[model samples]
Structure formats: structure tokens, C-alpha cells
Target: MPTTTALPPSVLISEVGPRDGLQSVSRTMPTAAKLAWIDALHGAGLREIEVCSFVPAKLLPQMADAAEVVRHALGKPGLTVMALVPNLRGAEAALAAGVHKLTLPVSASAAHSLANVRKTREQMIEEIRNIAALRDERAPGVKIEAGISTAFGCTIQGAVAEDDVIWMAEQAIAAGADESGLSDTTGMANPAQVQRLFKRLRAALGEHAGAAHMHNTRGLGLANCLAAYEAGVRTFDASQGGLGGCPYAPGASGNVVTEDLVFMFESMGVDTGVDLGRLAAGRAALANGLPGEPLYGMTPEAGLTKGFVYANGRRPATERLLAPLAP
Candidate 1:
């Protein structure tokens, strides 16, 4: 029960590499490799995965295999397969693909919304309502998550108002979104902002509030996640090897590194239910799956240190042998 006392009794780290990670990279991972990587991640004890975004193939050729990936993920037992859908059509495609969860990004900043999705804030809310209604009528059990991107600030439009983010969350929840959470789209979030926003979101939306999706643009991704955890947020969205960034936002690092985050929490006696050694193995699978794609993360390259005890037992032999080499 290390995590029980050190951190929340339980935490869910949602892997976003398949969707968010690959989308940002230029090379397309073959469908078979992507499937194998997903299998490896699940074997490492990752329960939820954002497999792909259900957008127009013409727009993001990388995600053209979203339906195939979704189908593959669904075949894995106890795995929660999630997909990003920009509009009602994408949502329909996602549901038809039998994904367990669907997330739609709704920007809090009007300018960012218009730039990213070509819709105003209100129009995005309406889209969520329509999608929710569609899900209710068609796939009653598929979970809908509203990812409020640019909840902190935007690169194009700086200093996004917190009130605006909270209002958007309210509107999405009111429109029947199963859950809503904030995304640091521009990587402009700080620890204080993350703590405050998540605290307010949980207070407003209660259990329907989702995770903290952060980027390491300023190297504060892990810090922001810790702040959210302190504010009672358990679920986190991360990518293997930190592979993901906003194409629209310059200088933003990839998603928080799954290996490092797991190490941070588990090292502090927090149980993430993720085996760090196995997680690294999963990352290797990821690399092999998409060769030539640049992967990011400190822990993977630096390796684990001595006396690192995982929640299950002593550090695996592979990790012990590969301890961080002398700098």
C-alpha cells in the first residue's frame, strides 16, 4: 500500500502515444506495429489508451488507421480504448469502431477555438451536445470525455481567462458530456494554475471531471500533474517516451513522459499499478514499432537508479543492470 499512503490509493495514467504521440510525428507507424505496441503497453499494466483520432484522413493521414486500431484495441480484454473525435462524424466513426471512450477538444479561448477547430466556443458546446445525444441514442455505454484544451493559456492568444475555461466545462457537462477535464494545450500552464483549475473543476463538475492533460513545454509537466494530484485529480494523460506536441503551438514539448511519471510516483512509494521496467519495455516496443521516429523522456535514457523498489517487488533485473550510467 505504498501508493495508498504516498499518493491516491489508485491512479489511472491514460497513454496517449498512439493518438497524440504519433499524430505529431511525420512517419506513419504501420498498423501491425501499432497493434503490437498497444499490446506491449497493456502488458505493462496500462489500462486506458488513446488509440487514435477519428478525423478526416485527408486532414491527418497519420490517423487514417484509427478505425483499424480501434478494432484491434477493442479485442484486448479489459483495455479501455479511447479515440479523439473533432466533430459528430468523427464521433460516429469512433462509436462504430467500438471504442470504449471518446474525447473531443474544446478550446476555452475563442481565438484558439476558431484557429484550431474552426468553431466558436458556443458552437463547440453545441457540437458536444449533439455528440452526447447521438451517443445516448446509439451507444449508451460508450463514455464521452470533453478535453478543454487551452484551458490554461494559448500561444496565439496569451493569458486565457480561467473563468472562460470553467464556463466551458460547465457547458459541456450540462450538455451531457460524461466527463470534462482541462488540457494545457499550449504548454503555458504552471503548477499554481493547474492546482487552481483542477480544484475548481472538481468542485464544479464533481466525479464527472476527468484528468490533467499536460505538456512539458517548460519542463513543468510532472510538476503540474503533481499539483493536480494534490488537488484530488487521479487520472493523468501521458505518452510513452514523451512523444507528442501541439503542431499549432511552437516550442511545446511532447506529452508528459510515462516512464518518468511512473518512476516519480512509484519512487515516492506511490503505486501507479504500472511496472516501470515493463513500462520501459513497452517504450522499446514503441520505438521498434515506429522506427526512425524521435522518442523523448529522461527516465528512459537515464535509466532507473539503484535501490529502486517497484510496488510489486525489487526492481527487475533488466532495470538493475541498466541503472543510469555515469554522466
Candidate 2:
């Protein structure tokens, strides 16, 4: 393998398969299989992985073993262990489990907020504030990201106002979040809308702008991701095998597929530091853990383009033609 330069990875692909992906599925993956799947994701060079959410077991039984999964992920050297926290209690639990990053979902659509988190937008802001305070008290090192779900449009609320999305991101920052990002909760975002809103988010929050979580329900997942990139978003939340959807987000589908997302960037001469071959192996683990789950993603089905060379491969991007990995 060629030594990658010291330059930071051009994009950060945050694997959300273990958390968002699993939660959407019906089966409760055994703790061991989840651990194995996470290891595979790490092996594929994903530096960050959301291992699970800290919701109550009765509400989301799939994530009942959040602590154990976090514990296992914590052992990975140089890996950022992340988890979702819907409230202060969830934040506390995630902090206790030693997560390095916390993503708190605060819906942008008023109706979605009430339906998803059982709180108004104001209440969710309060939760973000309290969670930030708790993080400072116990684990000052843990970074908090306030994710503004339904930032584009909500199935329940119809269309989320662009101003409201900006306001939510700004408020989240003022409420003590280290960063605030946008999510297309209902998968209703178009490329233009994605770029426009992200530009506004960056303007409102500046350096605190975070990840883009887009869904592929309407088949614009990759395009929307590209639009966000053009708008300066460098962190993205994707799932292996395209496995994720918000249970509360009626009619929404899977998230941007990790394999496809990685390929998109790498093919564009942007280094994502992810190995598609290894990502496929991770998908295999996902299938083995929960048989009969319908996986999605085009790259996984259409073989890599001939002469495909990863952006971080031996040759520099300018000189590299796509080269297949040696068998």
C-alpha cells in the first residue's frame, strides 16, 4: 500500500449503519454481530462511526445494547466513537459509555419535532443545552453536534421554511452545541435546496456547521450530497448497504449508501480514506447478522468502473487513471 500524505482526509464519511441503519430495521442484531460489523466499518477506514442511539430499550429495542457497542468501539485506535442522543438522559448514558462525539437530533419542522421526539422545537433546544452542560460536567472532551432533522421538508409539515432551518441551526449553536448540521428527514430535498440551505446554515453557524444526512427515497441522495459538498459540508452520515430511515419520518427511505458515497467522492478526485472493497465486506457482515434485509446502493451492484483508482491510491489524483486493486 502507498503511504497517504499527512494531509487530512478531504471528506469525512461518518458511518451510521450501526445506529441509524439498525434502528430502522426490524431485527435486533446480536451485540456480537454489531461489534463485528463495526469493526469491519473501522477496517474500511471510516474514522467515525455512530455505534448506536441511547433511546429507552422499550422504545427502540434494537439499540438496547448501546453501552456494550460503544465500549467495543472505544477500543479502536484513532476511531471516533459517536452515538445519537435524543434527550439529556440519552446524552448522559452515551457519555458514561465513553462516546467521543454526540449527535442530538433537533427537528426543524415543528410538527416533526413533536412527533419524533415528543417535544416542541423549543424543548429540543433545551435538551441540547442540558446535554451540553452534562458533557462539560462529566466529559468535557466529548463533542456535541445538534442535527436539525427535517431541514429540507417534512412529510408531516409539508415544506420546512428555509428560514426555519437556518434558525434551528443558529439556535442549536447558541444553545451550546459544538456544531449543527442538516438532515433531509423525509428525503424530500432537491440538489438546489440542499445547496441553498447548507449555504445558509454555514453562514448562520460558520465553523459550527456539521454533517449532511440525506436519504435516497426519491433517488437524489448522491446529488444532494454533492450539492452539500459544493456548499462546503465536508462531513456526511451514510450507512453501509444504504441501510437507514427515520421510523417517524413517514415515507422516507434509506440514507446515502456508504459504498456509493465513498465512490462518488473518490471518483471525483476527493480522498475519503475509505476502501470500497472493505466496505463491501462490512455489508456482508450486515447481511449475515440480519438475513433477508433488503440492501440498496448502485455501486455495489454495478461493478467499479474499469481502471478505477481510489483518490488516495499510489498515484496522485492528477496522474491517476482508475486502476483496479490487484487480486
Show the colliding residue pairs in model 1.
3-271, 241-296
Clashing pairs in 2: 307-322, 307-323, 308-322, 308-323, 309-322, 309-323
Q: Write the per-residue lDDT of candidate 2 for residues 1-327, one digit (tens) a residue.
A: 998767534999999989999998888999988998999889979999999999999999999999999999999998999999888889889999999999988999999998877899999998888998898899999999988998989888798899998998888999999999999888889999999999988888889999999988888899999999999999999998888775334343568888889989999988898887767668778888888787777787775777788886633223321223223
Per-residue lDDT of 76 in model 2: 99
What ranges in model 2 sit over 4 Å off? 1-9, 247-253, 315-327
TM-scores of the models, in the given order?
A: 0.92, 0.92
* CA-only RMSD, every prediction: 3.8, 4.6
In model 1, the runs with Cα more than 4 Å from the true position are 1-8, 247-252, 312-315, 320-327
Q: Tell me how candidate 1 scores on lDDT.
A: 0.86
Q: Show the lowest summed lDDT stretch of 10 residues, model 1.
A: 318-327
Q: With candidate 2 superimposed using the best TM-score fit, by how many Å does residue 111's alpha carbon deviate from the native?
A: 1.1
